[model samples]
Target: MKEIRVGLIGFGTVGSGLAEVLLAQQERLEKRSGLRIRLAKVADINISEMPPQFGDVALTNDAADLIGDPEIDIVVELIGGIQPAKTFVMNAIAAGKHVVTANKALLSQEGRDIFAAAARHGVEVGFEASVGGGIPVIKALREGLVANKILSIMGIMNGTANYILTRMTDEGIPFDEVLRDAQQQGFAEADPTYDVEGIDTAHKLAILMTMAYGMNITHNDIATEGISRIEPVDIEFAREFGCRIKLLAISRNHGDHVEARVHATMVPERHLLASISGAFNAIHFTGDMVGNVLLYGLGAGKMPTGSAVAADIVDIARNIATGSVGRVPPLSYLPEEISDRKITPMEELSCPYYFRISAVDKPGVLSAVSGILSQHDISIESVIQKGRKQSGPVSIVMRTHTALESSVSKALAEIDALDVVAAPTVKIRILEEDE
Candidate 1:
């Protein structure tokens, strides 16, 4: 049997778990793939704290040792971020070594350059663990669903954001409270900016869009909105409408342009995406032939994500064993076919919206608000006026018919400028069941 040596970098949570998987499952992997897959070396800044399972493997602080090694066939980069990770990946590709990575942020931002380098060097790059952890969505899009045209991809990609929203929805807790609890529970980081602010989801969405639509897009191109603004009252209103609020990373392919946005979306309670609670991640895909397919699993963790990394390693190893490294293009499309498609501006997209307006508890407040909506051609579907206070601000919740986002913004601006309006109107887009 052919021996394909593997070098792992960044022996952190995912790297350590990958080491365990490759070491523990060595027999099974080799038997299944007809290749001796070996975890040959690991590189990290602090090698003194290396795990016991990797005692038999070589360890180093400098990543160049692995990249320079002639026998190492693949380099798996788990060290995330843009700086050294990008440098390491480029160096590995330059060395003519197959690369596997779980860095969504780096890939989403610097994928074009990395893939270009790999193409130039006649090597392959496997990044299955970037988006959905162990969900294998990448392979599904690249291989399983290749026969069909992908219509849309809506996913709950970030575990921290999902956990906070799920807790807030189920327990009626406020956003800040749930966020604090999530941090204490290790579901959220100390900053929590990337996950909560939808940056993390946007990164995954960029990767998904590339794989599905072959669109040359990045996270910066996505219009991102976080869940920090969501409150218990919004959750209650969503419940009243028989829906749930989830921070959704949504992308749709129009023939002319694509729609990509990450925001808090209200999906009907009966929808599968709505029912995906807690930190578990789920992606709902609509394809021309497949209709709707849902892939659900833990989006992040040591073993689950590591398993994804290992799957990539095995795939690359098999390709190496067969002398067919670039059998599948990194983005599941020919390099020349991937082009920059126009992204539909968020303002031009039309969808039903949920609005919570704080207005003075007076009869004219509704008339003023409705007049603004009517002027903007935004028809109201339902209205619920919460408990009133004498000449004090009251919450006036309204669900509008399908309205252009620009129109909604214009109408909300006019409405908020009214003297009776007490606060900026809270707007959350509604995802219809059929959509």
Candidate 2:
């Protein structure tokens, strides 16, 4: 049997998991693929206590040793971030080694240059593990759904944010409390700015937008809003309005522009996406022919991500055994075909909104707010000021019809300036998709 040699970098959680899975499933994978897969080397700055099964594998502190090795057929970079990871991947492709990575941050931000280098070298780069851990959405979009033009891509891509929001909404726990619990359970990082603040989702969304729309879009193009400000009161308000709050990464192609945004969105109770709970991930895509498709699975964690990475490695091995390298362009489409479709600015994005205004218990306050919204062409769909009478301040919840984000922002500022409005107004974008 032809042997495929693999070199793994960054033996952390995901790297360790991949090593363990490969060890346990090597015989089965080889039997199924009719080729042998061997993990020849592992590299990391600080190596941890690995299981005894990997004792024979060469362990090293230097990345150059693995990348420069002529016997290595594939180099898997689990060392995330932009700098060294990008440099390592680019070098591996130059050295004639196929690359597989779970680094969404680097891929979304710097994929254009990396994929271009892979194309130039006539090598392949696999990032099936980059977006949804073990969901296989990448393969679906790049290959399975290749026959159709994808209309939209939306999902709960970040598990940390999803856990936080899911716990908060389901258990009625406060955001801070739920986040702390999630941290204790290893679902969230100590500093979860990327996940909770929506940067992580933006990264994944950028990669999805690239595959779905064939655009060279980056995560920076997304307008991000975190769930940190989401209070239990907001959850209660959503429940009252028959909606659920989820931090959604959404992107779609308009007639002339693409819409990319990440925000705490109001998903209806009846929508399938509204029920995706806990630290799980789900991607819903609308293709021209398929209409709608939803993928759900663990979006993060060692085993799930390892499964995704291993699948990519095996796919690459199969491609190598068939002598068809670079068979699929790095981003699913041909390198020459990736377009530079523009992303619509946040100001131009239009959607229904749920707003909570904390104001003094005074008459005519609703009228004043309505006047400002009407001036901006925003019409109120409904309002609820029930049971807030005897208080120093009251939160009046309101829902608006579809309106441009810029107009809503301006109207919100005007509403916030009123003396009757005691505190800053809160706004959550409503998900108004048809069934």
Candidate 3:
């Protein structure tokens, strides 16, 4: 068996798990690939925290040590970020080494340049773990679903956000309380901004849309809204309306344009996406030929994400041994083929909405609210009042008929400005089965 050496950068949580997988499943992977996969070197500044499983593997404080090594056949960049990781990946490719990575942010922002570099060097870049941790979604999109024209992608891509929202909905706790608990339980980072604020989800979605649609979609192209403002009352309303509130990364391929956005979505209970709970991630994408498909699994963690990275290593090893590297482009589209598509503006997004408004318990408050909606060409499907408080405001929940986002925004603006309205109305986009 020809041996292929693999160098890993950043032996952190996912890196440690990769070490564990490589140590424990070395024989099986080599047998499956018909190529010996050797753990040649690990580069991490904090080598003290390296897992005990890495018995005698070489360690270096510098990443270039591995990138420059001519013997290293594959460079797995697990150091998550844009700066040094991007430089290292580019360098490894320039050195004629294949690359595997799990950096969604880097791939979304700088993937065009990185893929261009890989193509120039005739090296493959495998990023199976970038989006869905262990779900193997990238492979499915790049290869499995290659035969079909992808129509849309709807996903709960952020495990931290999903975990927080799941806890909130299940325990009836508030967002802050659940977030704190998630942080303590190691589900969320201390900052929690990227995951909770939908930026992380946007990065993942941009990667997916690029692969699915062959459009060079970047992270900033997706309009994002966080789950920080999700309230227990909205959860109650979701249940009442046979729905569940999930932080969703959604994108659709309209004939001439694409709809890409990340926001808190009201998914119906009957949909497969609604069943995904806890720290789990689920992607529901539609294809022209195959119709709807659902992939569910752990979105992030030690073993799950590492398992994904290791799978990519197996793929790269197979490519190297077969002497057919660069068979698949990084974004599943050749560099010249990835053209810029128009990302649908936020104001034009059309969806049914769930609105929670707090208003003074006055007679014509409903009339005033409806008047604003009518003025903006917004129409209501159903409305229910959740009883009144003694002296202050009462909650009114309304589900609107499908309306343009601009109209809803303008109506909400007019409604919020009314003296009877207590606060800015809470709006959650409803994802219906038809869509």
RMSD of each: 1.5, 1.4, 1.3
lDDT of each: 0.92, 0.90, 0.90
As a TM-score, model 2 comes out at 0.97
Worst 10 residues of 1 by lDDT: 47-56
How many backbone clashes does every candidate have?
A: 0, 0, 0
Number of residue pairs clashing in candidate 1, backbone atoms closer than 3 angstroms, sequence gap of 3 or more or interchain: 0
- The C-alpha TM-scores of every prediction are 0.97, 0.97, 0.97
Tens digits of per-residue lDDT, candidate 1, 114-210, equal 9999999999999999989899999999999999899999989999999999999888999999989988988898999999999999999999999
Worst lDDT 10-window in candidate 2: 47-56
Q: Tens digit of lDDT per residue, candidate 2, span 73-143?
A: 99999989998999999999899889999999999999999998888887878999999898999999988
- Collision pairs in model 2: none
Q: Name the regions of candidate 2 deviating beyond 4 angstroms.
A: 48-50, 386-391, 433-435
Total clashes for model 2? 0
Comparison by lDDT, 1 against 3, better one: 1
Worst 10 residues of 3 by lDDT: 47-56
